[model samples]
Target: MVKYSEVIWMLVLFFLPSQAWAQQKVPILIYHSIDEFQGQGSKELYVTPENFEKQMIYLRDHGFSLLTFEHWQDTSKVKKPIFLTFDDGYKNNMKVYSIFEKLKTDQFRPTATFFVISDFIGRSNRLSKAELKKLADSGMVSVQSHTATHPDLTKITNYKEELEGARDAIKSITGKPVIAVAYPYGSFNSKVMEEAKKYYSFGLSTTPQYYSENGLKNELFLLPRIYIKYSTSISDFEKIVNGG
Candidate 1:
């Protein structure tokens, strides 16, 4: 049974011109922890579990199509579509996965990418190989790399171990092709970009801007993303979607 709101939302999305969101870059919101009680990171990064659910509800009820990292390409003609990404392979990310599982649907399927540290897997706070494989096998979610030890990519002396090791580790665990690498702590440089190219198709950063085809004169490795903190109000979410 379709709800009246769902019907209206779908109508608006299906009828809108694909180019309508051209001026505004599509938002790729980055998250860290999804717990009720705060952890070690900045409080702002810890979007409460309640707020997380509210956000998913808002996105679903308001016509937003949640695209997976691989499926993000399907949103070419639509506006207000967003990519939800999480980094640092926290054990608590399993909690976030549960939230997404509860919200799954055909049209409004929520997609997420977990960028994990290769060395952290099996540790107390990181995901194990089996867990990584499970998430990747879901086909709706992707398990990518942060780095082998979560080092600053730009600061590393040997680029090979820093970048490729993580790529290989994730591939071996998930048996999925690893294409994207999110910069640890959003740190990067030209050297980092060059190193990233050897192993990845996308290198995401912390800059909060919409992704637009028009302004991307640089290589695809320097893809910028929006940091979605607890402080970001629903109005801010609106602006992010509309590319304001």
Candidate 2:
């Protein structure tokens, strides 16, 4: 006769692999600029508007739900929730708004998250406060913190100014609670994570790994993202989303 402990062990062995195999892995695609670089810029940081549009259209036709950062809280609601996150809030990111407008559907709403440096707003190429507000109000984009000055959080001396300050400033401008943060240069530590928990509900990193709901409880602050470079072809893009 099998003991209760033996039965429990057997059940665990049976379910663990099934859960791991069937687990939903959501891809959070990270992008920097959505414009053509005339010259003198990292190619990895730029994705031409034409390519960006094609990517969005491909996601639309393939039935992938483009998610906002807020949606990260409850992945159970959507079947294929993929996040399109733009870092550094360049003025060119406004192009994403137009692209999303063209691709909006009843089942597949194209929404994205913009991680802006709060202290750099209204600078020459960065997004101004008004533009950030406009994007936030549109119901298609989320304005989140990339920190007040976009410093490496692990090296910062003032955690409050870097973490809380950015959250407060963006919340004030967008009139929405700043619930998420993307680390600058994808840098962080236990110290950063401890401080981040005080203000943010979610944290993002550039680890080039896709996130799944099953793994999040232990790794919320270290959630990984896949980088989408300018040279990523349509075939590779499809594979990236499909977890190939």
lDDT of 2 at 54: 91
Candidate 2 residue lDDT tens string, 1-244: 8999999999999999987678678898999999998676798899999999998888988888777767765566776779989999899999999988887878778889999999999999989999999999999999998999988898878989988999999999999879999999999888888889988988999999988665444388988999889899988999999996
lDDT of each: 0.79, 0.89
Runs in model 1 with CA error above 4 Å?
Answer: 1-24, 215-217
Task: Please identify model 2 stretches exceeding 4 Å from their true place.
Answer: 1-21, 214-218
In model 1, the worst 10-residue window by lDDT is 17-26
Candidate 1, residues 1-244: lDDT per residue as tens digits? 9999999999899768664643545678898887755466678867788778878878877888766556656767564677888988877788767877898777677778888988889997778888888888877679988988888877678778868988997899998888889999889888888888888888888876767666554546667788778787877766666566
